[model samples]
Each structure stands twice: as C-alpha cells, then as structure tokens.
Target chain A: MNEHSLTAEIIAILRKAPSVALFSHVSPDGDCLGSMLAIGLALESLGKTVTFFNPDPVPAGLTFLPGAERVQQVLPQPKPQTLVFVDCTDLRRVSLTPDYLRDSIVVNIDHHISNQRFGHFNWVDDQASACAEIVLSLINQLGVTINRDIATNLYTAIVTDSGCFQYSNTTANTHRLTAELIEVGLNLALIHHNIFDQKPLAQVKLLQAALNTLELRAGGRLAVMSLTLEDFQKSGAQQELSEGLVNHARSIQGVEVAVLLKEVGPQEIKIGLRSNLWLNVNEIAAQFGGGGHKRAAGCTLNVSLAEAKQGVCQAIEEGLEIGRDH
Target chain B: MNEHSLTAEIIAILRKAPSVALFSHVSPDGDCLGSMLAIGLALESLGKTVTFFNPDPVPAGLTFLPGAERVQQVLPQPKPQTLVFVDCTDLRRVSLTPDYLRDSIVVNIDHHISNQRFGHFNWVDDQASACAEIVLSLINQLGVTINRDIATNLYTAIVTDSGCFQYSNTTANTHRLTAELIEVGLNLALIHHNIFDQKPLAQVKLLQAALNTLELRAGGRLAVMSLTLEDFQKSGAQQELSEGLVNHARSIQGVEVAVLLKEVGPQEIKIGLRSNLWLNVNEIAAQFGGGGHKRAAGCTLNVSLAEAKQGVCQAIEEGLEIGRDH
Candidate 1:
C-alpha cells in the first residue's frame, strides 16, 4: 500500500482500539522515548487507554521529557488491542518480544535505513531525521492537537537525534519542524543544556583516560585508541559513556579511519570504527560479524585487549590500502 | 531613525558609493568572517570595488569560505569611498584606526547586544542572532540576487553564531533563513564538519591534559580545571586549543560554576568562567576587571597562577553562597 493509505489505515486502527501499548527499542534514547510518550499521551487524551513501555528506563540525560517518568520497564499482564513500536529498526530490537505481543496487532514506525519491516503494518521513512518526526505526522493524521508537552517531547527527540541539527541527516524539513516546535513555548535553552551540556564526572574521566592512550598510525591517516577494563573501573563510568569516544579519533585532521578497542570482558572486546573520508569501516566491521552505516560501525572480538587492538588495526590498515588502490 | 528608514538609508549609501571597504573585528570568528565576505561579495556583484579587511588572517576553519583567500590583512593605502564595519561591536574592535579611515564615512552593522553604535551611520539589531542575517537583509534591500556562494557564507555565519541553531538565540527566523540557504545548495554536512567536528590531534591532547586536572569544589557545585605552561608544552597544543575547555568543567553534573585557568606567562593567567545556573559570571568577571554575558565570561590576571586560582575560586564560592542565601 502507498504511504498515504498506510498512514490512514494505521490511524483507523489506532482510533478503533480501546487500548494501545507503545514500545521502543531497548536502552531507549530521546527519539524513541519522546516519540512513544508523545503518541501515548495523545492517545490517552483521545479517551483511549494508553501505556508506554520500554525495555529499560529512559537515559538519565533525557529524563527531563514530560512523560519520561511514565515509561514502564515491565509490560502490563493484559496486552492492549494495538501494539505499536516506535524507532525500532526490527521487532527483535524492542527487547520484550513476549508471546502476548505476537497475539496483538503490530505497528512498526522507524527512520532507520535498515528497518526490517517486521510488522503487520509498517511505516518507515529513512528520509526523516527522527522517528519523532514521523510521529508528528502520525499525530496530525490522528487529528489530535499537539499540546506544549507533546511539542516539547517531540522537539527533544528531533534535536537529540539530529545532534542539535548538526548531523548530515538533518534536512530543511528538520529545521522547519523544529521551528514549529519552538513556537509551542518550548524552552530551547533548558532542553539544549540538559541534553548536550550536562555530563557526569565519570564520563569526563573516561574521555580523559581514552584520550591519554590515543595513538596515530598509517602516517596519521589511521588513529586508534583503546580502553582497558581497568581504565573503565578506575573512571567509574558506564559503557554508554564511551558511546561517542571513537568520534574523537575520527575527528583528528588527516585521519581517514579511527578505531577504538574497548575491553568489555576478560576475553571480550568491543570495537568501534569511524571513517571520515572514503574508507568503509562498515565493510571491515561486517567481516567480524557486525554491521552499521558506512561511516560508523562496530564489532566484538573474543580475545585479549592487545589481540583485539592488533586485529582491528590490521583490518583497518588493509581496508585503507585497498581503498587507496581503488 | 526607525529601522526601516535606517535600512533604506544604508541601501542608498551602498548604491551611491563607488568603492566600499569592509572590515570585521580582530580574531574573526565564523560569523564575522562569513558576514563580511557575504556583504563584500554582494557589493562586488553590484559592480562596486570591495576590499575586505581584518587585522589577522581568517581563522583556518573558516578559510573554506569562497572569498576567504582574497581577504587582506593589511589595509590598502588608498581609502575606499565608504568604510563599513560588518560585525564589529565598536570601531575600536576593527583593529584599524588609520587617519584615512578616521576621515571616511563609517557604517556600523552588528548584532552584539553591547554594540556601541560608534559610527557615522549605525545599524545594530541585537535581535538578529548573527550579523550575517542583517547582511542578508541588506542584500535584499540592495536588490542584489543571492547566489549560491553568498547564501553559503550567510548560512555559515548564522549556523556558527547560533551554535548550529542550538543556542537560545536561534529563532524561527534563524531556521527559516537556514532553510533558504540550504535551498541554495549549501552542503550542511561539510560546513558543520569543518566548523565543529574537525579538530586537530593537538586539541584532543590538550583536552586530555585539562580533564586530568579537573577538580570538584564547594560540594561539587564549583568545578575548576587549570593548565599550566608545562601542560601546554607537554601536550604540544596551541593556545587556541584551550578555547572551550572551561565548558568541560561546566558540563559536570551539579556544577553551578566552572572555571578554567590557562597560564599564559609566569605571572599572567587568563581565566574563563561559565555558570550553569543563577550565578552571573559576568559580574564575577567584572570584579576581576573583565566582563561578558551572564552565563559565560572571562578575565585576565597578572598574578601568579596559584593566586589567580585562589581569587577566582573565592569569588565563585562567595557568589554561590550569596545565590543560595537569596
């Protein structure tokens, strides 16, 4: 079915359902949490029983969203008439795939290019910078008024997903939508500060430790860094704190490929790879049974930190050499 | 004069002038450089001779601008028909006070709240997020068609000054103008990466050293970090790498006030202060014979680094105590 017809059918299903359960991916981010909460609140306003579900609590940085407190980790015993997933590329990514969810009608909404379309009704728009943007359209199709709270939630989703509109995914529509959201009395300063500026001391400590071990390779074309388990323990930082650390390596001038080896276990290490120019880190990561976008990708190795670092560096070197030949 | 009449008057002046010399503040940022270039290009398109002037060469990051290569550091011996200050808050900020400029008609265009209106004709609109936005208006007033190069320059000016539209200064007009700029074939990703993401390895090294010295004080409400000349030498980082280091301190959770001390000489230290909440660092900076906005400000001390740190910490502690009492 065409997108217009699919949107209309989804709206019809939502309106007729007496109760709806909204789910987002595990380890929920601002886009998923905000989009889910905004839709859940809108449905509740329409006199429909609505429940918000996530595999985990919202990230502390994003708990400032209006309905963030209502996000439940445990799905209610009785399933709702309609089960909707927001921002999940695949149903497996939602984390809580119980038998009950299978019995209920599934609706999938996402913006990821790799969406599996694993739903009875699927609406995926990779062109959208954030799933919250798609939800904005969904809310409009449902003929519900977007209150200030809803506007704030969706705005946070878009802003966070777009990296405050600095990311390449951000488009003219992104700015226009953000402009509309701003008109809804949202406090841009407070939101931007909470999401971007505020960071735990532990995270800064981790960043410092990571930067201390930074090494340049391939005549400064390849940059690599590693974080031992001891470093993490000393820093007292969560694994999530290392999320964007690889970007630091990739950001260095003259670096085409950046690799970060993070020891997650005695014999297990997770590797993050980022490319600034033409090198495809995704292909390299895919060789290790991992996959992601062309510029950013990851893989896990069950080996000592030194072995993992050596293996990844070799792979990156080979990749760069091949790219140069091409 | 009303803003409309002022704009019309400025347009008339630009049309009548056979030659125009454009100038921006010293140590030009993206906003000043972008604004100056856009206006200079627009005036040039009108078949008028335009000379762009700055005390220093354009910053490296902003050198990607189309006409940046033509920006002259030394002013030409002959004076132009009109002397226009693009983004200078005051005439003195332009860094050129030659006798020839003193006799020329000065047109001041700026968006700073503290602009002194020190010109024969002043056009200061603090409401505009960037001076480039006002230049866009001037281009429109002059009936000059905005080509791709002009749009890209103005877009970079707005994006940088508004912190890529994340700062509170970003408004609906900012987004609308950015959207228009994007329509003119502006590569948002390249501009954003150049301005924000791309950083030297030296900068990351400097950040690591700064974070190593991060200290929590006043019950973690005041966070402070300092970098001595030795740290600079060890890191092999330039002085400019410390530009946003104070923000690292401010980003710490529960940090109401953050301070960064950079030892420029044995007895000279420059201090940067950032406030997350109610404390006005500007007032604190004023006490140290410096000034800036309420949240972000700076000052320089000619005392030993230790003394400077002690004095600044005491001022911050007192400010916090007073704020709590109030």
Candidate 2:
C-alpha cells in the first residue's frame, strides 16, 4: 500500500482502539521519547487511555520535555490491547519479550532503515529525519490541534535527530514540518536552551581530558582520542558524559574516520567510530563484533585501552588504504 | 510604504539599472558574503554587469561559497551607477567614505535593527533571521530561478545567521525559504561539511587550553574562562582561533553570564561576554568602554588579565543581583 493509505489505515486502527501503550527504545533519545510523547498526547486528546513506557530513564537534559514525567520505566500492568512502538528498529530495541506481541495489535512507527517491520501495522519512513515528523503527520490526519506542548516535543525530536538541520537526513520536508511546529507558538529560544545549553561543568572537564589525548594518523585521514578511567575520575564525569566527544575528532579538517576509546574497566575498553563522507565505520565495527549505521558505530573490546587503540587504529588504517585504492 | 510595495519599487529600480556594485560589511560573515554573492549571481543571469567588494578577505572556511573568489577587497576603479549595500547597519560599516553615495543610487538591504536606512531605496526587515532571507525574496521578485549555485549561497547565509536555525530570530518564514532553497538541488551534506566540519586542529588545541581555565562563581551563575599569551603560544593558535571559546563557558548548565578573557599583549586583555537570558550584557559592556547587543558584547582592557577578570566579575555579580531583585 502507498504511504497515504497505510497512514489512513493506522489512524483508523488507533481511533478504534480503546486504549494504547506506547513504548520507546532503550536509552531513549529525544527522537524516541518525543515521538512517543507526541503521539501519546494526541491519542489522549482523542479520549483514548494512553500509557508511556521506556526501558531506561530519560537523559537529564531531556527530562524537561512535555509529558516526560509520564514515561514510566517499568512495563504497564494489564498490557493494553493495542501497542505502539516509536523510533524502534525492532521489538528487541525496546527490550521487551516477544510475548508482548502475542495478542496485541502492534503498530510500529520509525525512520530507521533497519526497521524489521515487527508490527502488525508498520509505518516505516526512512526518508524522515525523525519519527516525530511521521507523528506530526499522524496528528494532523487525526484532526488534533498542535498546541505548544506538542510543538515543543515534535521540534525537539526533529532538532536532535537532524543535528539541528545539519545532518544529511534533513530534507525539505523536515524544514516544512519544523515550520509548522514553529507556527504553533513554540518558544524556540527556550527549547534550544533547554535542549543544548545545559551541559554540566564536569562534561567540559571530561572533554578537556579527552582532547589532551588527541592524535592524528594516516596522513590526517584518521583522528584518534582516548580517555582512561583516571581521566573520568578526575573530571568527576559519568560515562554518558563521554557522548559526543568523538564528534570533536570527526570534525577535524581532512579526517575521514574518527575514533574514541574509553576505558570502562581494568580490561574493557569501549570504542566509538564515526566517518565523514565514506569509509563505512559500521563494517570496521562489525569486525570487532559490533555494528551500527554507515556513518557511526561502536564496539567493546576485552583488552587494555592501549591494546584496543592499537587494534582499532590498524583496522582503520587498512580500511583507509582500501578506500584510497578504490 | 508596506514591505511588498517597497520591495516592488526596489525590484523596478534594479531591473532598470545598467550596472551594479555590491558592498559587504567589514569582517564579512556568511550572511553578508552569501547575500552579496546570491544577488550578484542573479543579476549576472539577467545580463547585468555586477561587481562585488568587501573591505576584508573572506574567511578560509567560507572560500568554497559560490562566487567567493570574485569578492574584491579594493573599491572598483569605475564605480557602477547603482551601488547596493548588503547586511550593513550603516554606510560606514562598509569601510567606505560617504563620498561613494554622493552620485550613486544607493540601495540598502539589511536585517539589523540598527540599520540607518541610508539608501534612496531601503529594505531593512528586522524580522528576518538573515539578510539572505530578504535577498531571496528580492531574487524571486526579479524573476530569477534559484539554481544550485544561488541556492547554495542563500542556504549558507540563512544557516550561518540563524545558528543553524537554533537562534530566536529564526521564524516559519526562514524554514519555508530554506525549504525552497533545498528543493533547488542543493547538496546539504557537503554544505554542512564545508561550513561546520572543517575545524583546524590548532583551533581544538586552543579550545583545550581555554577549557583548562574554566571557573564557575556567583553560585554557578557566572562562568569565566581565560587564555594567557603563553597559552596561545603553547597551542600555536592565533587570536582569531579564540572566536568560540566563550561559547564553551556559556554552554555550562546554570550559567547566566559567561566571560572569556584573552591576553593579547603585556597588560592588554580582550574580553568577550555572553548572557544566556536576563542580564543586559550590553549595558555592562558599555560601562567598560565597550558596547554591543544585549545578549553578546565585547571590550578590550588595558589592565592586566587578573584585574580585567576581577573587574568584570564584580560588575557581573552586581548585574545578577539587580536582576534577582527585579
């Protein structure tokens, strides 16, 4: 079926359901949480009983999102007959057992290319920069007026996933949808502040420690940065604060691949890989038994930080050599 | 007159002109350069002779912008009868004497609230997020099809001035205009790369040095970061490389006022100040013989770095205290 027809059918199914349980992916980001809350709020306005669930706690920076307090960590008792999964590639992404789908009429909405279509009714639009874009369309078709709260959630989702409209996934449709959200009286200044300007001092200290270890290799095509356990303890930063540090490496001029190695334990190191134009980091991560998208990926190694760094550097150099030959 | 009629009049004037000269403000930014180039390209398509002028050289990162090479730093030998000023608040902003306006039919196009309307024809739309927003409308009215080159320039202008659409000046119209530009077959991924991802390694080292001096005071409401002359020498970074170091201080959670002090010479320090919300940084800056907008301002201190930091801190604390009582 065409996208419009599928959307109509999903809307019909949602309208008829008496109650719905909305689930977001584990380690919920602004896209999943905002997508879930936006649709859940719309469903509630339609007089349907709605419950929101996420396997992990919302990140501290995103806790101010509208309806964020309603997202419970535990699964709802007496599971609703209808279930909606937002921004999830598959059921496992939500950390739920397959039994949850046994009797429920599952509806999946996502923008990931890897979505497995685990839902009885799936509306997967990989063209969308964020699943919230799809949810905005759904809300419009359901005849719900987008208020400030809904607009805030939808705008945050789009900005987060699209890197504030800097990513390749951002299309004309993304900006048009954002325009619509802005027209709904969204306080963009406050939203941008709440989402982006709340970095802790510890996070800055952690970044300082990370930058001190910056190294360039392979004719400046690969940039590497590492953070030892002592760096974390001295900076007083948690592991999650290490997020986005690899971007600093990837942003360097002429660098095709950027890697960040973090010592999580005495013998375990976490590796994050990012690429600019080419050189799929996912394939390199797969060699280490980990994987993600073409541009970003991650892996874990049961070795010391130095050993993991050496191994990843060798693998990345080989990959660059192959790319150059091609 | 209303905006539409004024725009129409300006279009009529441009359509009749034999030749045009475009001028950008000193220390040209993306909005000025992009706006000037977009209009110049459109006029060239219409078979009108066009020349571009800037008082300063284009920044290295922006050299890839379409028609960037054509921006001459010196005044044209034979000035065109029609002279256009883009993204300039006043005639002096172009670093040219008012004599240039003596005989020419001056056209002033800008979005700054302080624009002096120094042109026989002026279109200063303060509501515009970027001067390019106004230029886009003018190009459309001039019956010029937005090709990839023109679209690329206009998109850069909008993105840079809007802080990638994160700033408060961005409106529904900004995104709507950007959507039109994207539809013209612009390569957004490459544009984003050229504009944001080409950070020099020295800039990162400079950022590391600045972050090392990070300090929070006034109960975390004030964040101060300083970089000494020795820090610059150690990082091997120039003065301009300190452009965004203040932002690192501003992004910290609970920081209302963020300050960066860069020691340029013996007993000479440059001060950059940014406020997140309430405090009028412009007022504070004026008291120190410097002035700018409310949210961002700058000044130079003849005192030592320690004295500069102490004076600014005391002034900011008083400002914060006053804001609290209000």
lDDT of 2 by residue, A1-326 (tens): 88788888999999999899999999899999999999999999999999999999988889989999999989888899999999999888999878879988899999999999999889999999999999999999999999888989999999999989988889999999999999998888788888889998888998999988999999999999999999999989999999998999999988999999999889889999999988999999999999998899999999999899999999999999999554
Each model's DockQ score: 0.67, 0.80
Instruction: Pick out the ten consecutive residues of candidate 2 chain A with the lowest summed lDDT.
Output: A317-326
Which lDDT tens digits does candidate 1 get at residues A177-249?
7777777788888887788767888888888888889999988999898999998999898788898988888
Q: What is candidate 2's CAPRI-style docking category based on DockQ?
A: medium
In candidate 1, the residue pairs with backbone N, CA or C atoms under 3 Å apart (3 or more residues apart, or in different chains) clash, namely none
Report the lDDT of model 1 for residue B13: 93
Please report, as a residue range, the 10-residue window in candidate 1 chain A with the lowest summed lDDT: A94-103
Question: What are the per-residue Cα lDDT tens digits for candidate 1 across B1-326?
Answer: 89788888889999999999888888888899999999999999999999989988887788888799989988865877688998888767876554555677889999998888877789998889999888988898899988988988998899889977877788878887777777777777677767766687788888888888889999999999999999889878879889987888898888889999999888999999999767899999999999999999999999998999999999989999888565
lDDT of 1: 0.87
Per candidate, native contacts kept equal 0.73, 0.89
Off by over 4 Å in 1: A12-18, A96-106, A118-120, A141-143, A283-291, A301-304, A307-311, A314-325, B15-18, B76-78, B98-106, B141-145, B283-291, B299-311, B318-323
